[model samples]
Target: MEEAEAEEQQRFSHRQRLKAAVHYTVGCLCQEVALDKQVQFSKQTIAAISEVTFRQCENFAKDLEMFARHAKRSTVTTEDVKLLARRSNSLLKYITEKNEEIAQLNLERKAKKKRKPEDENRDFMELDADVVGSDS
Candidate 1:
């Protein structure tokens, strides 16, 4: 009986940690937004949003973990996040567009780095040739 009670206590402690991990600032932000809109948000309303946001975050993390497991990967990639966002068409489109934009930016940066050294070497060679010809 004591072992069972100890197990229960451990479970409760774990749950407390999990709940603590989720911040309640989202609820405060919601209340602020309600004030801006001239809508009075009660404590209950803030609590509800906080609970819902925490559940949503928990669900998303679970889904991402499932995707990672399905892919036989220990780490979740951006693809896993995109797959999770696939439930909403607008969200999927936005993620896709943003991913493309990031890829383009990375490619541009690589190209710029590659060009800089080659251009500098070419300029140096031209300067060397001009100096040699002038000495003649």
Candidate 2:
């Protein structure tokens, strides 16, 4: 009976260590930030946030994998992440706008690259025209 009790205690200690390892430290950081807002966070509040964040991340990973499989792709894309964020309307709007902004930036970068050579040629042509007209 003593041996069984010792083994049970060991298992309990191992489980406690595992739980501590998985506990999100960022939740404590968030709680510290909340203190600045005059909000007092109890242990329960931190635990709840940690638990919810873990569940959310786990669910998002699972959903993203499922989306990749559904699309017959081996890799997940930004669209999959955006789709997952779409569950929250505000989040969906934010992500969509950010994506559009990123797309616009990319287009601008490509245009700038394409224009560089044309701009150089135009400048050279104007210089040549000025030189020839001045000599004439």
Candidate 3:
């Protein structure tokens, strides 16, 4: 149907946009590194690096998808992400630490869930004040 074709076209367009954004970000990072090293990079070199980074990101996504599917889950979970990071010990450790931090934060949030509405509003006000203070 025409709708299906249109949806496919939209998906392809979104992908191209994502690729462009990633390419631009990779180029900027490469430029920064090259400057720090007092070296110049050619267009080809930047393009190559961007391509590799983009490919790696795509592979990581596919891997997470497969990991979730293998676990018989419709959504990717933290365990799936941890499995993906298993190739690098440091990454796994970092993720584990981050997960612990998130868990602690969740516990804190749940403990605060029974607080009065006024307390929650005050918390938001405090957060806003902090943001404003930091902007000065």
Candidate 4:
């Protein structure tokens, strides 16, 4: 039971690290894209990057480097970070895909319910005709 608890803690820690990586990665990318001097950061500088804990900075740097290399980009931009964040993490990707799917399903449901006035009128006319014929 203790072993199981330890494993769970390790798993949770890993997830937290990944989430921190993504957040820090985005913050760095935002700094780059926005060209804001107010936001200064370096991979070695942990205190500057508030999104990630000091211990996680090393891992974040490694992950960010790998992602940058995979993209074959000389500089990491917000778009690249976003793509990396989405691609490297299954949970993030799943959530994003699920959200998009839900949105599409909702749009389809709304479209299906949207009847043209002409079609509605035709149905009403048919019903009226049936009622009159029955009365006769």
C-alpha lDDT values of all predictions: 0.86, 0.85, 0.91, 0.69
Q: Considering only N, C-alpha and C atoms within 3 Å, which residue pairs clash in candidate 2?
A: none
- Candidate 3 lDDT, 1-136, residue by residue in tens: 9999999999999989988998899888888988899898888888888888889999999999999998889899999999999989999999999999999999998877757677989899999999999999
Best by lDDT: 3
Which ranking of candidates, highest TM-score first? Answer: 3, 1, 2, 4
My TM-score estimates for the predictions, one after another, are: 0.72, 0.65, 0.78, 0.31
User: Largest TM-score belongs to which candidate?
Assistant: 3
lDDT, model 3, position 118? 72
**Comparing 2 and 4 on lDDT, the stronger one:** 2
Q: Kindly report which residue stretches of model 1 are placed more than 4 angstroms away from their true locations once superposed.
A: 1-28
Residue runs of model 2 more than 4 Å from their true location after superposition? 1-33, 131-136
Instruction: Estimate, for each residue in 49-84, the C-alpha lDDT of model 1 and write its tens digit.
Output: 767777998799999999999999999988998999
* Better by lDDT, candidate 3 or 2: 3
lDDT of 2 by residue, 40-118 (tens): 7777877787777667776888999999999999899889989899879999889889989999999999999999999
Better of 1 and 3 by lDDT: 3
